[model samples]
Target: MQAKSRALHEFGATFLGPALHVYAEAIESSGADHLPVCLAREGWCFHRLLKRLQRDHAIDLPRDPVYLRVSRTLLFRAMLGSETITRMALGNDFSGSVLDLMRKRFGLQLHEIFSALPIELLRFNCELPKDKDTVFEWLSPHLKALTTVVSPTRRALTAYLERSGLTDPHVRPLMLDLGYSGTIQKILTHTLKRDTSGLYFIATKPGETAVGDHQALLKGVFHEGVGWRSGCTMLDRSLLFECLLTAPHGQMVDMRQKSNGEFEYFYGREAATQRHFQDLKTVFDGAIDHVIMCRRHGVTYTRGDVQDLYEVFATKPNCIPHDVWHLFNVDDDIAGNGMINPMQMFAI
Candidate 1:
């Protein structure tokens, strides 16, 4: 096991060396996001992960145009959901770049939405219910109230899905993310009204819910295959999820409808946010270059390779890098509780 572990690490050092170097450079250059350079590093990691999915998993992912279209739409929708919760939680105190972004994105005065909800149910860092039905029950009213805001975005997303071939019968729409119950996937399926599946880099367990004709499915690449697996893999590699899946922008709050009958997204941002995005872009570009080079050289990654590395980490917490310790510590309790265990970072 030790020999194989050493071999895998060496392989990573060699195959992923350039990407790692780029990550290091991005980290050294940025201090915009909380906990040093978290968001920028995440962009680097996400690019590598996406490349792996496209290559090793044979997911039929498209290049820039499709990739950007899907990523931006999905991210905007997901962040809009989060920002709604934040507004409910923070109330008047929620004023900031994030709040402003939500207002602009959704084209709604957040105060009205917050005023309509039972704000007492929300609190700082509060976890939404695990039961999808219950969450829907809670959010349904809010969703209905924001229908005008969300509907146009949903329509835009459906068109985007069609253009990306996800809505086509011959195409299987698969989305990838860091891990856990695929709430994003579920919401997307619900919105797109398509049978969309998610292939998470790492997952806790499986959660399935049927919404109309669409069903949300999730599978983990490394740890859990179908559902949550009770093991050290999820715990030891918890930090890995954090460092890889972050977005550089403030959470998107809503969508504004245009007089032209189209919807435009609103995201929270400031000068610091642009810096974070620029740093993230450097990492992404470097990773893309690394992936292209590897592909040209016939370098292939497999699920087995990922599992081997995960096994070593599962059994040895000390194997995690020292820099990840602070971020790891930030959400140790959440990991212990079996929740998503994501770091607040730029989102909060």
Candidate 2:
């Protein structure tokens, strides 16, 4: 267990090194005027690291990064206010029952969705087609009912954003997140009706396309291209990075404003008491220690270094104990995907 924890910590530091470098470069290129905002809960580490680095004079930023309490589920639900929903908003692919869609996408309970959805649709609560287009076609007829049920949530999200100063007229937010696609950034650009900039650890083809579509300025720190190309092997096991760089909290499921003008947050269930929770925490601590050490010694790591480390862990299953693999789990409750082991997300 000690060896496994140390390996994870070292890997975490190496992973963050290049990401931090790229973030600095992004700040330079995009101008220092934009307010840096880290998207939760993946961006939680980056936000913390940035503040730490700034204190040590390892990196400098015009303003502190804001840790925004938003999620893909909340953003997707907010898009329901629009008359037309894009493929991105609907998700690239979907696989679940209608009930799952209601609960996951709109945060509707069974009782709440039962009253809104037609009887015909309710009967097919087994599973929906995996193809997003097919799912969208099936949902086309009932969008009105779905939107009506979810509109209040959208209003709440808008209010939350406003309360957080994300919608401030004078400030432009540069979103930071560990990335595959820039879905959150794209949605924010649309919702705010303003062009936004995003700095990601990586941006897949869909993300690059969103740059043009939404007029977003997005840069992938490590590899920004279509799929896992020759040099971008890390994208193959991206979920591992997410597992390491998570916040010690449950995912934000819903938010509402009270009559007193205060906001209330609702979170999804989390496995904080899971057996592997302490191990996960230790790995995070290792990463933070690495950052401090690097700053103190003026040491820097290259992207090549990050990739090589990735290869070591990716190729050698023995590097991590067999028991530790199954113990680690990540939640994708936003999509109703449930808990998943990061190692199991890709074939190693």
Candidate 3:
């Protein structure tokens, strides 16, 4: 992440020469609606995390340490949902703000906050090749393929289905399970929680007007796929990225879940109230290294650029499996989360 952030900063500074700084976001919107965890101490660890990533990646960083701290703080403020929540949780009297006017005085780098925590990213392996250009193409070619594909099945269910009792396809328990998974995800995931919706307008940039329409900047990019290519085509996903930038709005959907469960879709958003997809996208483009506590250890997570990274994180980045399962409205909970399916404890 540190290496990637530096390259982007150099590119932006040398080429575009726009501000020589990037306004980054932290735990971006989870593309879809789902209650996100609001951790008060998240920012507290961000600074240290940045250093850890730098050391791990062996990247040369600036001398002034405080900038790193501030950068992470801003990233946390932007991505974690709402500033109001962060303000309230961290305390009513918060400082360390790096907004436009304040930015000149405290120009923080984007790398600081991103490398804060370590999460163990489960090994996706051959299951899904990381392709930023066409995540949708690589993962799910057809939405229905999300269900009909092979899944981790309960051994007994398979044996039972093979027996004569399951002569009728519609009546079969496996069929019912598959049907329930899709039906429930579509219905419940769509219902909105005023707080977690992906597309929203927080506040117009004080004086910084939109480049094109001069409208309140808002939108997100979300993707859902298990493998490299599945239901949606890669071209479609890439086009979606372009669309979000040019078009008025849309949230990036990176939520990845399956009919059964091995992997999952992460439902996420800032802890702040009333933030929009655009804000999330901006913040996401900032960070350096996000920790995965477990698997995928010591491996560099090379995706797209800051913009591309935002798209990946927007839908499904290093997310907790349980979190994703609930967020995207999938029904693979072994403990019977009833939101999608009644507890199948008896069968298990």
The prediction achieving the highest lDDT against the true structure is: 2
| Candidate 2 error regions (>4 Å) | 1-30, 125-131, 206-214, 228-231, 271-279, 321-327, 334-336, 344-348
Residue 256 C-alpha lDDT in model 1: 44
Which residue runs of candidate 1 sit more than 4 Å off their true CA positions?
1-65, 68-109, 118-166, 206-209, 226-229, 234-236, 248-250, 260-263, 268-274, 277-279, 300-304, 308-348
Give the per-residue lDDT digits (tens) of candidate 1, residues 1-348: 355334433433433434333333332232222111011223335554455545554223333212322332233443344433323222212222323323332334566446544554332222222232433355555654545445556566565445545555644455545555664565556556677665554556554557457776665555564432355554444554453334554334434446785657554332232344544334344445555555456665555564565555445545644322333222111112222322332121
**Best-performing candidate as measured by TM-score:** 2
Q: Which pairs clash in the backbone of model 2?
A: none
C-alpha TM-scores of all predictions: 0.53, 0.83, 0.18
Model 3 segments more than 4 A misplaced: 1-45, 53-57, 67-320, 323-348
lDDT (C-alpha, whole model) for all candidates = 0.43, 0.67, 0.23
lDDT of candidate 3 at residue 190, scale 0 to 100: 18
Give me candidate 2's TM-score against the actual structure.
Answer: 0.83
For model 1, the local distance difference test gives 0.43
- Model 3, range 1-348, lDDT digits (tens) per residue? 455444433332321111101211211212222221111122222333334444564333322112111111222222222222222222211223222111211121234222321112111211112221232232223223222221221122233223323223232111000010121111111111111111211111111212222222122222222222343222223321121221111111122234563222222222221133333232223323324211124433221243444334334533212211111221211111212211121111
**lDDT order of candidates, top first:** 2, 1, 3
Clashing pairs in 1: 102-253, 105-254, 105-255, 105-266, 106-254, 106-255, 204-228, 205-227, 205-228, 206-227
